[model samples]
Target: MAVIPVAIAGAPYEVRIKAGILAQAGRHCRPFVRKNRVAVVTDEHVAAKWRATVEASLAGEGIASQWLVLPAGEATKSWAHLAQTVDFLLGQEVERKDNVIALGGGVIGDLTGFAASMVKRGCGFIQMPTTLLAQVDSSVGGKTAINTPMGKNLVGAFHQPSLVLADPLALDTLPLRDTRAGYAEVVKYGLIDDAEFFEWCEANGEKLLAGDAQAREYAIARSVAAKARIVAQDEKETTGVRALLNLGHTFGHALEAETGFSDRLLHGEGVALGMVLAARFSARQGLMHGQDAERVVRHIGAVGLPASLRALGLDCDGRRLADHMLHDKKMDAGTLPFLLMRGIGQTFLAKDVDLGEVAAFLDEELAA
Candidate 1:
């Protein structure tokens, strides 16, 4: 078991990673859960797989679990489901002092955490992220949100989980395509500032995707530690230090909006292509070497992620895609800050980006 500490000053917590941790969920979550009855929020797909095991574990600890299993997908992260989840928790008589469990992937964690944040002013929640994307990225950072018609993650709050239990055994049930998509975030840490880790990924990413237990644990622990250090420094993203974490997200979110935030392009798939675009765009502006940009594209393509915007076959023009970014949460003073790379490990936020120029670049990418 690898325990990574998220050192947020007032709400420090631990992300415990291990194989079969979900089977021992009750034992691990005993301290944070206060009452005999606990409310667990999950999705229909996840409930069918691990729900019984989790229920049995909690029962062994003399706790009764009330469950709210929602329909699965990005669409579930909406105002409608938020109200539903909040109502369910209220129906269960959850208190601000009590902890509820978020027992699925990113969708469950985001929705449940946001619901917990609003119930009775605020309440604590536990994160049992069952996906690689959630385990490595979304589950660790205290950024809980739901997608709005305007954009992804536009309406939400910073509600930290009391504890995060990531079980590698969960991935054994995940589809290979979903696992590969989640692996994109794992590669993001390397692209953010850890070139050596990027090299490690170049060598071991295939093995990690192939279900190597040691590799999965190491990658999750390392990614969590990196995020913990950043979150501790800039909890609210007021400082630019935390912005590094959004290296591929700005562009990725735009792509998601373009695709209507549907299964046509998974969040991680959008991010994978976004990182490629960021790199290639960096190279186009001479901020990074062309060879370095191609390297990023090579790794992303090798991993079977979408590395080319042209291949998406979108009928919209570049201007329309850039328009989607106008609704981005990071838009400030009529300018959107872009994450561009100087190299694999060198990402910086550039605020002087012109959307027209970005449209032109996208046009070029779309044409290429």
Candidate 2:
């Protein structure tokens, strides 16, 4: 088992990664789950797979388990769904002292954590992420939210889970597409801070994707460590530091909006394509070389992730995408800052940029 500690300002947490950790959840959760009743918040998909193990564990700890299954998709992470989840918790007599455990992918984690954060003003949240995406990225950070019609993650709170239990065994059930999408974030940790890690990913991503045990554990631990450091520095995203974490999300979320945020465009795939565009745009501005852009695109494509602007199939051009970015929740004072790169393992947000130039550049890229 790999125990990764997340030293954040509000709370110091840990992510436990192991092969059979799901079966040992009760032992791990013994401290926080004092109340007799615990809600296992999961989606239909995950509930189908790991319900037996989770329920058995909680039951062994003398905690009654209530399985609250939501629909499995980004659309379910909304105010209405969240309201329903809170209602379930209330109906189950889930007191604030008791804990709510999220047992699925990012969608389930985000929705359950948000509900747990709101109901009775606060409750405990434990992440039992089942997907590669959740294990590597979303499960660590406290950023929990549901999408609004205007944009993604518009309504949410910073609610950190008391514990994060990442069972790599759970990811075995993930679809190939979802697994590849999750890798995009794993690669991002390298791009944003560590060149050595990035190269390691380039060398071993194939084995990791093939479900090699050591590869999975190493990638999850390293990715968690990278995110832990970032969150510790800037928990609320007020400083420019946390925003770097959204390296491709600004463009990626807009693309998701255009696609109705469905299976038509998975979140991580959009991010993969978005990162490619960001790198090419940076190269175009002479901040980085074209080869760097190609390197990112090549590796991502090699992993079966989206590698080009055209692949997303959004009807709009770059100017239109830029316009959509204007609605991004990250915007402040009518100026949108972008995380642009100077080279590999290097990216920084530039706020002093003109939208017209960005729009023109997008138009040129679209025309090209």
Candidate 3:
């Protein structure tokens, strides 16, 4: 087991990553858990596979743990679902010192983190990330939220966890589509920083996807390291350095909102397609070489991730897509601050961009 330190001012925690760490969750979580009760927030899908082991581990620590399992999907990240989780935790007689454990993917993490932020005004919480996407990206960042009608992750807070336990062994049971989908975020770490890592991914991505344990650990640690550095510089994303983390997320969120934030276009899939679009748009603006964009597309495409919006087969036009961008949280004064790249490992936010030009580009891309 490896514990990587995430040192954010006023929000320092560690992200522990290893295979088969699930069986020792309580031992791994001993430091943060002080109160007697622990709420293990999970989904029905993950509970069936690992709940017994997790429960036993907590029982061994003499800490009583109750499981709160919601249905599996992005829809679970909503007010209705969150209210239910809070009710369940309150019924479990939770206290401020007692902790809520996020024991599944990003949805569970976000909802549970939000609940922890509210229950008794605040409570201790731990993250047990099971998916590749959760391990490397969402679970590490302090960004946690539930979805609202206004937009995805609109109702969230930067509620930092006491500790994050990521068991890579859990990824073995994830469906292949979800596995490949996660690769998109892993690729983002490379795109935003560490051009060497991006090139390494292009070369060894197949090995990483082939279920190599070492490869998985390296990806998680390196991605966390990069994010930790960025967060150290700017925790709340107030500084533009952290905004670079949204490399493909602006267009990606638009795609997600257009799909009603459903599983039709998974977050990572939209991000994959969004990264492709950002790269191509960078080339169109003379910020990057066209071949560099193609290289990004080809690498993501080879992994079976969605590298183009066209592949989603949605019945939408460019004007509508550009309209979706208007709702993105990053928009300010009607200008969408897009993360454009000069090349791999060289992304900067572009404000003062013309949405009319964006609409025209989308129209042309949609027609093609």
Candidate 4:
């Protein structure tokens, strides 16, 4: 087991990673779960796999779990489901002091955490992130949100989980495609500021994707520790320090919006492609070497992630895609800050980016 601490001043918590943490969830959650019965929010797909395991674990600790299983997918992260989840929790009589469990991938964690944030002015929640993407990134950051018609994660709040229990064994049940999508986030930490870790990923990412337990454990621990350090420093993203975490996200979110936030483009897939574009765009702007940009594209492509925008076969023009970014939540003062790379491990936010130039570059990329 690896215990990484997220020291967010007033709301410090621990992200516990292990091979079978889900099976031992009750033992770990005993301190935070005050009631004899707790409410668990999950999606239909996840419930089919791990619901019984979680229920049994909680039962062993003399706790009864009342579940609200929702339909799975990006669409579930909406105002409709948010109201449903909040209503379910209210019916369960959840109190602000009580902790509810968010069991599933990013969708469940984001929705449940957002629901918990609003219930009774704010309640607590536990994160049991089953997907590798959630375990490494979304589960720890407290950036709970739901996708809106305007954009992804446009409506939400910063509601930290009381504890995060990440079980590596959960990946054993996930589809290889989903696992690969999750791996994109693992690679992000390396691309963010850890060139050495990026090298480590270059050597071990295949093994990690192949279900090497040790590699999964190490990568999750390292990524969580990196995020914890950043979150502790800039909990609200007021400082540019925390904004560095959005390295591939600005571009990635735009891609998601253009794809209609559907399965046609998974969040990590968009991010993988977005990182490639950021790198290539950085090179185009004379901010990074062409060779360095190609290195990013190579790793992403080698991992079976989407590394090319043209391959997506989108019918829209570059201007239309850039228009989607206008609705991005990160937009401020009528300007969108772009995350561009000077090199791998050297990402910086560039606020002077011209959308028209980005459209031109996208046109070139679309043509290339």
Candidate topping lDDT: 4
Candidate 2 lDDT over 221-268, as tens digits, reads 999988988988899999989888888887788788888889998999
Clashing pairs in model 4, backbone N/Cα/C closer than 3 A: none
- Candidate 1, after superposition: displacement of residue 268 in Å? 0.6
TM-score-wise, the better of 1 and 2 is 1
Native RMSD of candidate 3 (Å):
1.2
Segments in model 3 whose C-alpha atoms lie over 4 Å from true places: none
Q: Residue 181 of candidate 1: its Cα lDDT?
A: 88
TM-score, cand. 1 vs. native: 0.99
Better of 3 and 4 by lDDT: 4
Please give, for residues 222-315, the per-residue lDDT of candidate 4 as tens digits: 9999999989999988877888888778778888998899999999899899899999999999999999999999999998999999999988
Q: For every candidate structure, what is the RMSD over all alpha carbons to the true structure, in angstroms? A: 0.7, 1.3, 1.2, 0.7
User: On a 0 to 100 scale, what is the lDDT of residue 92 in model 4?
Assistant: 98
The lDDT of model 4 is 0.93
> Which parts of model 4 have CA positions greater than 4 angstroms off?
none
lDDT of 1 by residue, 1-368 (tens): 89998898889999999999999998998888788889999999899999999999999998899999999999999999999999999999999999999999899999999999999999999999999999999998799999998999999999999999999899999999889989999999999889998998999999999999999999999988988998899998887788888877877888899889999999999889989999999999999999999999999999889999999999988898899989887887788888899998898889888889889999999999
What is candidate 2's local distance difference test score?
Answer: 0.86
lDDT of each: 0.92, 0.86, 0.86, 0.93
The regions of model 2 sitting more than 4 angstroms off are none
Clashing residue pairs found in predicted model 3: none
RMSD of 1: 0.7
Q: What is the lDDT of residue 90 in candidate 3?
A: 88
Score residue 166 of candidate 1 by CA lDDT: 97
